[model samples]
Target: MWHIWTLDDWEKNIDLERSGHRCGLRLRFDKEVDSEVRRACKEFAVFLRREYFFPIRVVIYVKARERIIAMDGDKCCGIFWCMPDDYTIEPYIRLAAGDYEKLCKKWGKDSALTNILLCMAHELTHYFQWINSIKLTPIGKERQATNYADYVLEDYAETREHP
Candidate 1:
């Protein structure tokens, strides 16, 4: 199972108040997976909260999926589920173990890490859009999420390169 942590866990274990007024829940990966991906996810979470002004708790689940490989072939990279609340919606993100391994093998660890961050950002954007009352069809919503992720990743890269 993936390393699962909830908001309550973060609240009790982590310094929530110091976490930039936003709380994050992190899921740890197994030792076999590259640790850099985990670090990037956390960093991206902070970036999302600090830059986007979205107070969010990022829950990282590492190796939590029942199937390590992608059932739907290699086309599907990962999955993200969002539950919208009145104030905020929780996002659940997962990457297929097979996909992760395949990407790492093909693109190296750094590229795989970047991909995960992009996917997470995309999923989170969808939740935010829903909360903000953006009317969209299912496909449209997915497209919007992808677009948001692309935009954020581009922005993040530019900022990092210059700063």
Candidate 2:
């Protein structure tokens, strides 16, 4: 069943950086999620904050099939929204937990989390572009995001293997 959540429904919120009055890394997970999955996601968010800077919030919806539709009206794994009022509003990301689970079953937990992390990284790339005023065509943006995600995952693997 689809359970809509308000800002108050955030259970996995974290402040990545708080230099002054800026908010950071507001993460939310559905109440029905497994503890293991929740832990992994939280840890990954912290890792992302450390590795890069972008996006102020992330919401992961549980297997609510209809609730996580993209702008094209098709079911999507994730989306990153860039607010119009850049100075007053910050970007945020949303991910589908169902897709994460499917990847886990097919690729094992760590690999699946890696995939989900790639999705998050892709969204993050958009935020990076938005903040830096980097302009690109829609196709160029997607290609860049995909390349960035792959670069991130490769770097992560190297860190794990060497460190």
Q: 1-163, model 1: which lDDT tens digit per residue? A: 3111111222332243564445444565766555566567667666765665333554545553323334445344455555544334455556544356667789887687677777666656654564355668989878877877787788787756321
Model 2 per-residue lDDT tens digits across residues 1-163: 3211112222233233442225446577777655666676676667666765443443434332323677888776678776643434555677766555666678887876676667766776766666545568999988988988787667666656321
Error of 1 at 76 (Å): 4.6
lDDT of 2 at 21: 27
| Worst ten in a row by lDDT for model 1 | 1-10
What's the TM-score of each model vs. the native? Answer: 0.62, 0.71
Model number with the top TM-score? 2
Q: Whole-model lDDT, candidate 2?
A: 0.59
Model 2 clash pairs are none
Best by lDDT: 2
Backbone atom clashes (below 3 Å) for every candidate? 8, 0
Model 2 CA lDDT for position 112: 67
